[model samples]
Target: MKSLKNHISLIIALFTVLASVQIYVAVDRTIAAYETRLKDDYSVIVVSNKAFVPSEFKSMSSMIERSEPISTAQVLDRLKGEMSQKNLDLLRLTLPKFYRIYLNRYPSPKEINNLQRLLQRNPAIERVEGFAQTHDTIYKLMLLFKNVVQVFSIAIAAVTSLLILKEMRLWQFQHAERMSIMALFGAPVWLRSAVLFRLAIVDAIIATIILCLAFYVIDYYGFLITQLKAVGISVQLFNFVNDSLRSLGIALGISVALTFMIVIFPNEED
Candidate 1:
């Protein structure tokens, strides 16, 4: 019974680390999707004395998805009754050409600045407005959110890893006398430490199974899905096949690596 309890405890610890990692992955994907949606609604306004073709900005073509000219008729409509037809004609002739530039994706602040500089370098462009203030605020908020998740995931993984390490040490101590006896015989180090390797592998598999089921339940019926829906960010909470394989790989890799380290470097008491 005590041995079973230890196994369960180790599995739970491993689950904590794996779940944290998977949660971070989901949050990152969701944020990236949200940023794409934001990009569709965001655009830069450019004013030029001469009309610009979409190809004029070809130097930065990778950053720019397309350019849309803002019609001068809209401005004329606003000042319709305020001016005579002759004055309107003169105003239209003097009014600068306006364009709205759309990007392929939301760019970082540095990228925005570089794009603005590139646009300004064009001889025809008089001014370019990238809405830097609003863009910076939103970008900073996204960075803060992602950083918080990263830090939280790291902390959880670190603490749980220590717990798993402690549990492994306890298991090693429990079988230390047997290992010593085997060592005194002709048994190799690998044979003497076979039990620890087996325990680590078994616990890693059990933890991965629990993690897969927990995420599956969360994906279908949890508040996380509802919350993301409310915010209009649609993303899969977990990818069953891909995520399961990744979690299993990470769990097995960490467990086996740690077990090997402990087995190879025994304490003075052992």
Candidate 2:
């Protein structure tokens, strides 16, 4: 039972580290998806003295994906009942050309400023509305979320790594007598440390398998998808092939490093 508990403890530690990293990955992807949606829906309105060409704006700023002219027909229709046909036609002809320009991706505050300045520099453009305030608020919030997740994941991984080392040390002590006896009998260090490496690899694989299976179940059930939909966004929470491989790699790496550390630096008494 004690041996089982030890194994379980190591597995749990490994699982916690893997879980923290996976959480960070999931949050980062979700934020990226949200940003993509925002980019697709967001646009800048430009008022120009002359008709605007999308190619002209694209040439001015690589960020500009395309532009569409805003129709003034509804405004003219609204005035038809009150004004004569000639007056309406004259007003339509004199109206400044309005265009909605889309960008390929969301821009940072500095980029927004640059785009506004670029548009305003054009002799034909009368005004550029980039919605700076709204964009800044959303951008800052997303950045804060990403930073928090990163810090949290790092903290968890650090603490769990210490726990993993402590567990390894305990295992080393438990096996010290056998190791010492082997050394006295002319057994090499690698041969004596083989059991520790085996244990490490076994526990790492177990932890990775558990993590992958848990996420696969969560993904299959669409729990994360439902939660995101409630918030009006969609994210790809997990890719079994990629994420599983990544988790396995991390687990094995940590296990191998800590095990090697313990084997290389045994207690001074040894």
Candidate 3:
């Protein structure tokens, strides 16, 4: 029962670390997905005194993914009822050309300003609207969310590492007599510590398996999917193969490192 308790404690500690890592990964992916959606929906409007080819603006800024001329049909339709046909025809002839510009990705505030300035350098261009104020607010909010998640994950991992170390020390104490006897017989450190390595590696594998299964169940039930959809974003919560391998690596690394630390710094009794 004592051995079982030690194993369980170590497993739980490793599980906590792995869980925190996976949570951080999911949040990062979700934020990236949301940012992509924002980029797809955002655009800049440019007004010009004369018609211009969309390709011509691409040379000004490589950020320009593409551009399309904005039709004046809706404005013209609204004015048709208020103006005479001759007046409407005259209005169409005098209207400025407008183009909607799309970017390869969401731009930072400085990039937006630079792009605007480049566009305005053309004497024919009258107005450039990139909605800098609104974009800055959304960008800052996203950055804050990402930073918060990162800090929280690091805190959890740090705390769990200490817990894992404490548990490993307990394991070392339990086997101290055997390790001491082996040391007196001139057994190498690795040979004396084989049992600790075996126990830690076993618990690490068990913790990794448990973590992967829990995430699998969560993904299967659509809980993560439903929550993301509620926020108007879609993210894949688990990639079983890749995530499993990563979690296993993290679990083993933490367990082995802590166990080695205990072995290298033997207690006075040992």
Candidate 4:
């Protein structure tokens, strides 16, 4: 680790390997969870849980008038029955208050026109409208995140490699200018690419390990936080060490890759 550029390169390599893994896991988990929630919402729609404004009826002294709050269950049951008779489609249901989404046509567009008719005729019916959701927004955001992590990991690996290369080159030149000697020996240019590939594979392996640990830590912290919240406790300083180490590892790997490239490939014409 103390060795000049080589050690520096090694550190960076380790980081790239770890950071890639971490990103992979995070993205995977986030997307998976998001989809799961969406599915849950679609299958189960709850009626509005909004309590009636009690104060508005404050002047009504009659006990019966005061007690008759709007029935959330009644509204949902009526809506559901209407939809059934009309053969309408519902996309999802949400919340204690306002969490029901109706689809004009579901399962696909072919059935939508017919569904719409059913909804329009119902007495409890509100005007039905078709909706187009923005898939591109979600796609763009996910892609942006992926690119950022990729760049971070690559940069760390490259910088590390560059530093290592610089040391080796300097030593070679000082000892007896090995760069010139290699030219004389006609050492195939393939060597550079080969070395880079080796470094990449090594970095990938290290990154995978780091990623596994990252998920583990995230799981631990996430679980603890969830538990604390359930018990009605609040503690902030939640996670520092694990996150820092992960970042450090990524930065170091990128540096190594940069150093490796610079050292392996010389700009000077021999």
List residue ranges in candidate 1 displaced over 4 A: none
- Model 2 scores a TM of 0.96
Q: For residue 131, what is the lDDT in candidate 4? A: 34
| Candidate 1: residue pairs that collide | none
Residue range with the least summed lDDT across 10 consecutive positions in model 4 = 60-69
lDDT of 1 by residue, 130-213 (tens): 886775686678778888999999999889877887888889999898998998998999999999999999999999999999
Off by over 4 Å in 3: 132-139
Candidate that beats the other on TM-score, 1 or 2, i.e. the better one: 2
lDDT of 1: 0.88
- Alpha-carbon TM-score of each model against the true structure: 0.92, 0.96, 0.94, 0.38
Give the TM-score comparing model 4 with the true structure, all chains together: 0.38
Question: What are the clashing pairs of model 2?
Answer: none
How many steric clashes between backbone atoms does each model show? 0, 0, 0, 37
Error of 2 at 26 (Å): 0.4
Candidate 4 residue runs with Cα over 4 Å from true position? 1-5, 8-10, 13-21, 43-179, 191-204, 213-265
Candidate 3 per-residue lDDT, tens place, 1-270, comes to 989999999999899999989988987888788878778888999999999887898877899999999999999999988999999999999999999999999888888889999999999999999986875787689788888988988999999999988888887888888988998999999999999999999999999999999999998898879988997888888889999999999999999988888888876765
The positional error of residue 202 in candidate 4, measured at the CA in angstroms, is 3.8
- Local accuracy by lDDT, each model: 0.88, 0.90, 0.90, 0.45
Please write out the lDDT profile of model 2 over residues 1-270, one tens digit for every residue: 988899999999999999999989998998888888789888999999998677988998899999999998988899999999999989988999999999999888789889999999999999999876875687689889999999999999999999999999988988988988999999998999888899999999999999998888888899888998897688778899999999999999999999998888876765
